[model samples]
Target: MKALDRAELQRRFPEGVPVQCGKSSSSHLVSPNEIFAVESKMFFLVGPVGVILSFLSGGVFVYSNWSNVLGDDLAFLFLVPIIILIPWLIAYTFIKNERARISLFNRHYI
Candidate 1:
């Protein structure tokens, strides 16, 4: 981790070095909720890339299995793309919101 500036240390600590926020001074200052929120946002942003790759690979799989499993029912094939797309859309929305929130928080902090 980078060393803290004097002002940040003062704002967060206000007492002395090794000041506690909750548990340990060094380890427990950041909120887990905020960390989770940021991580969830990152997950959302990256999920679509994985989904796209998976969808393409699944198309190949479906093609390989079509004769034995699906027979001639090509209509069911549409469901695969829809399922991939829906989740990606939801994740994109979540990522957008989270990024906005992070930007706003940074602006306020800085």
Candidate 2:
């Protein structure tokens, strides 16, 4: 799908939407509840909570599937995609927040 221009978003929602992931229509025009959901997930998936859960889940998974997880010589390669995904998610989150900060509170659409 095509990305919506700044002018079009304003024209579409005069009052405005809560947050937008991007210029893409599917992620934009978001409601406050939707934003809250994402925030909650991030909260649970980050910081101390994330660390604890990671350890617990990692332990369980490793216990149940030790061979599948660590027996293979190439098992460590899984870290590659996870490393790439982390920065990408962070950047995307920042982009969405910047977009909201610049436009959601401004008098004019950005």
Q: Write the per-residue lDDT of candidate 2 for residues 1-110, one digit (tens) a residue.
A: 11234455555656656453556645445532222211224533454554455556556655666666666746545754464455556656765775665454343335
Total clashing pairs for each candidate: 0, 0
Best by lDDT: 1
TM, every model: 0.40, 0.30
lDDT string, candidate 1, 1-110, tens digits: 22223345346654434424555445434432222213344574578677877688767766776774446677666766675577567777877776776554444422
lDDT of 2 at 59: 60
The global Cα lDDT (0 to 1) of model 1 is: 0.55
Best by TM-score: 1
- Give the lDDT of residue 69 in candidate 1: 49
lDDT of 2 at 13: 56
What is the Å distance of residue 25 in model 2 from its true position? 41
Residue 38, candidate 1: C-alpha displacement in angstroms: 10
User: Cα deviation in Å at residue 27, candidate 1?
Assistant: 16
